[model samples]
Target: MRRQAATFVWRAALAAALVCGIGLLPWLTRTDPALTVLKARSADRDPTPEVLADIRAQLGLGDGPLRLLGQWLGGLWRGDAGRSWISGDEVTPAVLQALGASLLLMAVALVVAVVTAGLVCARTLRLGAHRRLDGRRTAGSGSAVLAALPEFLTASVLATVVGVQLGWLPALGWYGPQWTVLPALALGLPAGAVIGRLLDDLLPGAFAEPWALAAAARGLPGRSIARQAVRRCLPGLLPNLGLFVVGLTGGSVAVEQIFDIPGLGRTTLQAALAQDLPVLQAGTLLLVLLAAVAAGLAALATRRIAGPALRDGALSSLHRPQPPTRGIPTFVHGGLLTLVIALGLPRDPLALDTTRRLQPPSWTQPFGTDALGRDMLARVAHGALDTLLLALAIGIVALVAGALLGLVARVSGPLVDTVNAVPPVLAALLVTSVAGSGAATPALAVGVVAWAPLAAHTSALLRQERAALHVTATRGLGAGRWYLLRRELLPAVLPPVTRHALLRLPGIALALASLAFLGLGAQPPSPEWGLLLAENQPYAERAPWAVLAPAAVLALLGALAVSAAGGIRRARPRTSATLAERPSLTRELVETG
Candidate 1:
């Protein structure tokens, strides 16, 4: 018990230290925080050396990294989170206030997601086996579509349809209980899709179990049997729920900004823009802590409900060998690609029509005109090409580079591990610093960061495959290294790599959009989905169509990608038996009822 306590303490300390280190990232960058803050607040006014020195002193710039960290930690221990650089207000009070709003939003979203997932699961389970399979495909496709769209795009579309177009809700502002509905729906739909899909995957195996058969033999209703299956799957689902919450919290940045909600995500984004280090650091620390605590709670709940054996098994499954899930059909992927090209080929996205500025949707302007009088449909269509092309390029580059690196790492394990230890965001920032921002910058940043995981997975797989009996037999036949790799290893690796690439597409798109939203990706007038969201946000009230059109396009593309990937996975042959291998339950329950 003492040893376990010590281990827990060490882990907690390490997590805290890692979060603190991340909080120091803004300071570690080359840009001067004091200068940025001064420039943002003062506008055209130049800060002389004396004024700059004073500002630096005020920000504790004279201290080294260690000293600053120590001081910050000390203050934190005393219940002080320092002060905001922009307003000079206490960080704790502001953070707490913002946190309350964010939590409220999150709670609503969670309830919606859970209820929606439950209904979908219950409805799907009622069908006959053949009908269930068809239902599963349709549900999978719908979930994939929802999962593909980013939060900002979803929020914009919801706001436009329900709030602006139909007068059911206000377009913007967080006034009362009614205001939470749209944002919660926006957040809930994607999360619900994720949960629904997870349940879909788990239910089949559970339904195949002995217990399910026994329950059926006893003449219990399908719903009762389904409830038992759901309970059995809950242990697996809880950890994913925690991760979804963490992701939702992070994704709330764009959602909060679009809805004009004063949540911590919006506050952090504002601080990032202004380079308000104090507020940014505090916000980062708070978010990191929240994620860690939430994850820990999930683990505890899993252990309590499912016992230590199942909990440990679930945790260990991370390192276990797994089958490659197939991706969408090749013809479908090709068709989508062709469609994007056709949309972008003819129309000039940048051509202005000053006479039709901010026009509503009509026959003349299908998606209407933006504030700048650019045709929204043409720009969105063109933007699809840009977004898809960038994401594909990043995926190809990351895959190829990771494969080569994985080969090298098989020989130099320690060196690869050291390089892999560097945070992807830091690597991205360093690359951006050297490459400078442009059309290629976002891809470069995201690719460099994304390659590490692929490389690690590949390296591990290669290590396992290299020791297989077939490799030994090939060696006995005097097969060379290149020949063995080409004939044996490459074939084994390609399927998983392909699936990983497909799974990675949506993430790459979101990353590109995020960077573009942050002004580090595609610049204005480019029609990139993220850029459109950022640029057209201000005119959301007057020209709702401009924002909604691009958002819809983004969501549509994302859905296509997700659905395609999911279709491929579903097409793969099933390998594992359902409930036969699960840990047995208590004998009392088995014998009693």
Candidate 2:
């Protein structure tokens, strides 16, 4: 117990160090904040050296990064977060207010997701294995499709159908429960779909377990057996709830913006745009802390609820050897689509024709023309190539790096845990500071952030596979490490890795879009979807098509990726008896730590 306490203390210290390091990212990356503020406030006149020095001294920029970090930490310790540059208000109060609103939004969304998932699971449990499989496939496909839609698009559709068309709720505002209904549903629906699929997969193997069988042998009703199966699946399901929380929090940026909610997400977005360092840092820190705390609590709950037998059983099931199955159709389609777009699209996306600006969709230009009169079809097609290239780069880099690191992590567990604790947004911001604004920069930033999750997943899977009976037997029989890994572990790891990569593509695309929207990715006239949204936002009232075109394409791409991943997961043949019962160690670790 003492040793464990010491280890926990060390881990906490390391985590604190990581957070402090992240807080200095803005300072390290940019020109001094004083200079940026001076430039923003006084753009017309260049400040003399004396003037610049005065501003720097005023803002405490005279101190080095370490000192600045120390001061910030000191302030945090004293329950103060300083002031917001944009609003000149006390940062803590504003942050607390925004956090409260966001928490409310997240809580409502989570409840919706859980209720929906429960209903879906309850209905699906009544079916036979084949029928259940079919139901899962159908549900998974639908979920993937819905999950592909970005928050803005989902909010828009919900607002239009439920609010505008039906008048069941108001289209905007955040006053009453009726107002919360649209945003909550927008956030909850996709998450519910994901949870439902997870429950679907786990229920079959759970029903087949010894206890479930014994209960059935005692002539327990089907409903009772189903309830028992669900209870058994809870430990695995609990970890994903943490992820859903993080996703909803991150996704709230776009939803809050669309709905005009004064939440932390919107405040963070505003800070990022205005380069308000204090608010941005504080907001980011708040999010990272929330995710960490939530994950830790979920992990503790799971560990407490799951007995040694269940934990051991679940862990053992994860390592069971199985024949690998390939799902090649999605890859082929993706590659072909990318190739066609890259080759068939116009050479230049920036060519502007002023006379034809803001034209709506027609036979002549299927996607319409933007305010610059750039052919929307050409721009979107070219943008698709850019988006696809970014996703591909992120996917390849993250997968390869993650797999290699996963191997290392198996031996150096503590190091991996420390690294994984660093928030992805913080990492991205750090990368962005050094790399600057460009397609490559955001791609690299996203790839760097993405690698942690993939690495964790890969490491956990590899560790389990290495401990399998076949691997132990082969090693005892004088099989070399290379031979064992090549013949055994790689096959076991590849299928899930492939599926994970597919699922990650949509996320990468969304990240790219978000960064680009913030002007940190694929700079002006790039025709990237996010850039398009940012550029045309002001003109949205006049030419709504400018925003809709890129949004629709982005939505379509996301849907495609999600659908492909779901189909592959569904179609892959199950070779192990405990196939669906395996718990994801990476997921638990990511959420918990």
Candidate 3:
């Protein structure tokens, strides 16, 4: 165990370092002098011959990319970010400010995710016999949809419906807690869905173990069984927890830009747009670093949890247990969706003062005015409806498409595995970037990417369930193919499938939000979180904090997702009892002999 722990730690550390290195590339990257000169000339900001010579002398611009990268790496080791390209400002302070905001946002998001997910999982497990379905039934579907989305979708929807049309809150300002709602919800949905699905899928397996069966026979009941099983299954699961934190925060970049949240993602996007190399590099580095830490912790936890397959948390409670509700799924999911719409709406859905154009956020205007003099608040309010509608469409697109493709691939075996293993998000983004455009297209594009994983996971799960003892028993009883599939197969599969479907909401929302932020989803004069950030990018330096509020909201939403994922993971182990049953199997065989 000690040896395994050490090895896992080392490997995890290396993997985390690689993630950091990828993040550091932007900072350590050197601008090609030739390209810089050409770019500068095209912009009519060409440096004279003297300036070129001076730049070469000062920064060795003529050096190879490797050397420049190496030198930058050395400087970074000493904790220094070089000078700024545009304003000649020290990159340290600016980067620190952005990093601080980002860290704060990520931390806050984490809290939201843990609390929500944990409570949900604990409650679900505690509910015992009254359960309708394990959230895992839809896990594949939900994960596909959420993973396929970008950040901009949530931002746009919430900004329009909640911030503008309904006028319940300020769409643009970051003044206090009131502004944090929309973005947090946006980020949380998909993440939570995925987590919930994973837990649901895994938990049942634990419950079916001989010991769990014995506990159940003793009338321990379903809810107690669920909690006990989850407690025991942690050892085999937590290691799979990767840098979702990174994904969430990275998604936050666009999310922040849209809501004008004052997080690192917002600042970094501004840096990228302005070509502020130092700020961009630093901001990216911070994100990477945060992700790396999350990864390491996941790895460490995985290693520790593997021992005894979680015997500590496996103590079965001997108390009387209550029977659960039949078929009434927790409407907390509905509440989440409703809240998303609410955040998108404005209190004054009809109060539009369209007299001013491009007015800044203030007490009077609240969310302020847009470039076309439309009330930002109003635009944001309506945007909520659009955002939610689009996200729903996107979720449907990804879920159905991915399910189809994933199922096909699963039946195809190796071919499906290979294709699914590819970097799906990048591929989809590339396809969209190359061959697609507009709102629905991008959403579908992301959904397409998310499809393979959903298919693969669903296929694996269905295959396992189909091969379980119950299915074989049905077959022995001469059940027809259709009946076997409909009654036994479908029922077994539903929990995972449903959980997957529900969890996809938040991640897809984020993906949509990102597309909008990148100018892919929503276009100008439209009140959306992403477009809002893009509009504010030019003036980011003037009022950096303006963007912080919305960005934080997005981050918080993402955090909620992470929390849900954690909760789902805690719900149950997918292959529960396998390890725990090994010893029992040996004993049974010995006894038979």
Candidate 4:
């Protein structure tokens, strides 16, 4: 009871901190909310000091940030979210409406993601049971491809190809059930791929268990065994399932924008951009609440799924542990893409010719030109350096931070889970609101959540590794905590954490691009991949190449990262559980007997 109370207090504190931060964003950023509100209310009107004073007084901001936060909190307790500075309407209703839309979208997207993950896992298991040499290999490749593709790029391609070209689904708007399809898929597929890959990785060990062997010996079907294996993998995957839910709901800003959906992501982004403090605060508060709720539910679900065995430590092995992957294919694919981009980079990226604007791909301009007549090939080539470097830096930072923090998992677990729930886009929104959007904003925003996954992975692995007999023996010999952590733990933890970080590099780049696409990252004429996609989107109908070129490149980068991290062969850890080396029939007989 005390532990639960402490956890609740921590979550509440974090949520309050987030709300206060949002409320005070203007002041923190050195921007006067009165002026911002005045400008938003009447852009044409000159804001004299007297007028600013009047506006500040009207909004109850003359008392400073502390008083403002107190007033907002007081109002919030009374169910009054205040009024929007821009629309002059009640913030509560608008926030609620947006929340409803976002919830519905998140629910649908969650279903799609789960279904996609299920199908992928089923196929892999079926093939593996059949002794197909390519079971993991095939699934790994497909999942890597899907996981590497960024949400914004996926939304754009789906919008353009499926919604526009194929005329199958509505590419724009949020009116009916039909409108949800493309957006849900865009949000779900890549997420599903990630979840599916992790689940697939966990299944092999489950299949090699004595119970599984006994079941097979007792004439249980492959399908039933696979089902049990999935159930075993569930405890490991559920925590991340909560994270994904939060991500789908929170990080969906770009998708909502692309589809013109009036969800919380878009609403919060709009409020942030307009400096609508009331609406922004309400929206942010609600998101933080959602995170708290999601975390609680996930914990409940984990407990339920794990049952009493979890408390007894009987199911400890089912918890997260790194599955090593290979990288040759990743390099080959990445190199090919790089070579292709390099081959057509003779032209200056910044040099423009109006006559050549939106030109089709040709021998001279391999990837064609954008709206401004800047050579796409040259732009992509130049942008690669900036994008890749930033991603690498972010990955390294996340890895180091996660590793150190993960060592104190008991203390940091709640914090990690809570922060992990804040989507990169939402983080970008908050950061951009205070710091203003720039190249660094995306890095800071993405860095906030990127560390959580690695941290969680490390925490789980640390828990698993500490149970080793060698660690216990060393500790019995009077090895201090520091020595155990340094000589014993660090060596085991760093490699897997590094590998997890590698898998996440493409995602970091994609997230940066997504922010760029949403006007929260690199600005105009920058040619950063996401920015390029954003700039070219308006011209997608007239010149499809403008969009496809960058999208294709981003997709390739994703594939490279995923494959590099995953590798050609499953590199299960030496300590990982597996059936003893013996004939399958003999093992089955022994287990059954």
Candidate 5:
């Protein structure tokens, strides 16, 4: 009961902090709330002092943040979310309507994701069981590539080829069930690929367990064993699934914009940009609450799925890090070959020739020309250098920050969950709201949330490592915390965590590009990849290459990173008494006592 009370207290604290942060946003950004509200209400009028005073009084901007936050909280308690600054309508109805649409879209997308993950996992297991090593590797390569594709890029291609050219599905608007398919696919496929990959990595270890051996010896069918193996993997996956669900509620900003779906993500982003305090506060509150609730529910589901094993610590091993596979996948070689050709090309990205605008690809202009007649090949090549260097720098910084916080400081899990709940798009909006967009705005935004996953992973690994027999023995020998951390803990944790961070690089790059595409990053006339996609989107039909060039290069970069990270093989420790050599009794003793 006390533990549950503490949990409730922290969750409530997180919610209050989010609301307070929203209320304090104007002041933090150095903008006058009265002026912002006045402009939203009457943009044509000058901001005279008397009019500003009236608007301030009307919006209660004169009150301190604490008082305003308290009033907002009190109003929320009474089921009133206040009135919007832009529309002047009650906040509850509009937020609820948008929330409902988001929920429906999430539900459909979840269904699609579940099916795709199930199929991929099943195929992997089936192939592994048959000892088809080549087939398993090939199948995994495709999904890894698919997982690398960003939602915005995926949506753009699907909308153009399937909706516009083929005329099979509606590309834009939120009208009926038919409109949901494209957006759902855009979100679901990559999510499914990630889930599938995690599960595939877990299954091999589960099948190798003694329980599976006993089940097979007892004449249980292969299907039954596979089912049991899958069940064991679920406890480890549920939390991540919950995280994805929470992220989808706000991270689908790009998809919502592309499809013109008036979901919560789109609505909240619009409100943030327009400085609609009432709606922004409500939406932010709902998202934060959804994250907390989803986390609580995911924990409950994990306990239920884990069953009696929860007490015995049998299923705990399922959550530990697995040794990553080494050797570059065949797909990476293909990406490298393309890179070689791109490097050898000769063209000036800034050379503008109006007569050759939108020229098709030929022996001379390999990737064709853009609207301004600049060489697409040259632009893509140049963009790659800037995009890649920035992404690598950000990835390294994020990895270090996450490592220190997770492994050294050991930050609170609730704090990590709460912060991670804010998606990159929303974070970007928040930073943009304060800093005003610049080259570093998207980087700052991405940096804010990028460290969460690494922290979570390292924390989990730390917990597992702390229970190892060697750790217990070293502690018994009077080893201090720093000694253990330096000699044992860091060594064990850093390698797998590094691999995990490597897998995240492509995602970080994609996120940076997503922000750029949304006009929150690089400005006009920049050869940034996402900016290129944004510029060429309108001419997608007339000159598809303009869009496809940058998109394809981005896709290739993602695929290469995924393949390289997936190929990494952790080296074995040069110790006579390895962890694997330690008795099971020693581990059990350390865990239980």
Candidate 6:
């Protein structure tokens, strides 16, 4: 235990160190520029070599990269990220202000998502009889509604209907409580979509377990099974939660900008536009740190909650018990997988009637097309391919990168908090102006920015798997790392990991799709979901369903994904027959009549 704790600490330290180095990359490159610019101006001010010498010496520009880095580190250690050259104010306070808002919004949004997702997932997990049952699909559809709904279109609709039409709340960020609703809903919907899917998975497993059955045979009521089984299944849910949070934090940048919220995300947009050096570095660093912390928490949660092979062992024990019982696994398992797979099959909703543009849902188009006369169904089907491919692609790349880096930290000792501290996404967003309004770029952009989540979850899973009993037994069997990991470690972790990877699609889809809708995504004629909605947003008030149709389809796709991912596994949860085999049959009584 002591060794393990130490290892964790050492790895964490190493991650921090890497983050710090990466975070300061911008500052390192700017040192020469700072000197050159200052030195150039110095010639105009003074003819004397001594004056130039004094100017160069004062700013520490003559120093090498290492020397300058050391000096910068020294300043950083003292909690000064430096003053904003553009704003002329201390950079730290402005940053704190932005971070506070972002955190607050995230906190609020997450809470809403947690509740909404929990309820949606719980319905499928706790209440539903089997994975394919219509109840679970209803819950899935709810998530679909959330996921398929475009943020801009949703936000715009919310802005128009709730904010403008209804006159209930502020459209833009008023820095008050009421203003949070629209943005929170916009953000919360996709997150809920993920959570619902997770719950869908976790619940059915709980429902189909032998322990649940065992408890039931012992006169444990259905409610108790729901309660205890859910509790047990919850540990399995953490990894997904972590990934969702990681994605949310990373994705929040675009959302914040669209909503016009007074958070670091909104400020990040400003930083990118102005190319404000200090603002960019500090801002991106903050984003990186937030992402790292979220990832670390996810790792820690996986360790503390999952505890390696215990979960797999418990699940295995339930599935293949010592006692004989009629197999209840077939329908429940198959049905659930079928239901979840159904979601992956794309649906097209494009319509061709140009006569009545922007019409609501009708017999011709169940989900009415947008102003463009494309079928809502067809567009949604096409959009699914777009989002899934893009988000999954990015997640895969990040997974590879983060896993390798995390392994490096685990095996070797370094300051992890620092390495994990560097803000790659924030830095990129700050440095790069989102070029090309092409459909591909936004997805590409979202993927590039969200690399951390892939890394965090994959590495965390690897470390957690390393501690599983199977791995331990493999070690006991004198098996080498290759024999152990490839055969043992990878299999146990891969299922859940794959489940989560699939679950990520909806959220990534929503984020990328949302980006397109905001005009930061695909250019004209691209026909992506977000772009389509953004194009039709003008007719929102008069022809609401035209936009609503595509939105519904998108939401449904998200829902189908959650349903399918969650519904992948099912078993008839019966009480433990290991102790009381055929309790009723064994205790057969003569008819007293």
Q: Global lDDT for candidate 2? A: 0.64
Report the lDDT tens digits of candidate 6 across residue range 1-593: 89768866765565445435543544544433343334334435544566556644654546744665565456767788776544557778898888887777777778878877767765554453332333222353555556556555666767777887788888876478888888777677667766665555445445555676577668766666666655665554555465555445545665676567767766765654444445656775676566556646755765566554454542331111122222343344335434433542454344356775665666765556667566655565565455556766876765555545545545422232333233233434322333433445565555554544434444545554565443554355465666555555454454444546555555566666666654466666555666667777788777766576556555555555544454343232232233246555222221110
CA lDDT scores, all candidates in order: 0.64, 0.64, 0.51, 0.76, 0.75, 0.55
Number of colliding residue pairs in each model = 4, 0, 105, 2, 0, 56
Per-residue lDDT tens digits for candidate 2, residues 196-264, read 755664565565555766776787777777776676666655644665676676546767877878888
TM-scores, one per candidate: 0.72, 0.77, 0.51, 0.88, 0.88, 0.67
Clashing pairs in 4: 326-566, 326-567
Model 6 scores a TM of 0.67
Candidate 4 wrong stretches, greater than 4 Å = 128-138, 164-167, 316-328, 344-346, 433-438, 461-496, 567-593
For candidate 5, write residues 462-524 as lDDT tens digits. Answer: 655565555666566566677667666677677656756776777787888888889888887
For the record, the alpha-carbon RMSD of candidate 2 to the native fold, in angstroms, is 7.0
Task: Give RMSD to native, each candidate.
Answer: 9.3, 7.0, 11.8, 5.8, 4.1, 10.0
User: What local lDDT score does residue 491 receive in model 5, on the 0 to 100 scale?
Assistant: 71
Q: Per-residue lDDT for 1-593 in model 4, tens only?
A: 99878877877787777777777788788888888888878899999999999988887787888987787789987899988888889999899999888889998998999988887687767854543423233455666677778787788889988999899999999898899999999999988877886677667656655577688778777788778778876765666677788778877988998899999988987887788988888887787778778767866876787656554444423322334445677678888777966774665889989998899999888889998898899988888878888999999999999988888876667777678656677788778766776668888998988998888777766665575545554555556677667655676667546756876887888888888877778987787888888888889889989888877777787677667655433234432333355336333333433
Whichever of 2 and 3 has more TM-score, that candidate is 2
Which stretches of model 5 miss by more than 4 angstroms? 1-4, 48-51, 130-139, 164-167, 307-310, 315-346, 407-410, 460-496, 574-593
Runs in model 3 deviating more than 4 A are: 1-59, 114-150, 160-179, 214-225, 233-241, 272-277, 310-513, 520-593
For residue 567, what is the lDDT in candidate 5? 52
lDDT of 5 at 172: 93
Candidate 1 accuracy as lDDT: 0.64
The candidate that wins on lDDT is 4
Name model 1 segments beyond 4 Å from true: 1-27, 119-122, 128-140, 157-176, 308-337, 351-378, 393-504, 518-520, 533-549, 566-593
Model 5 per-residue lDDT at 298: 73
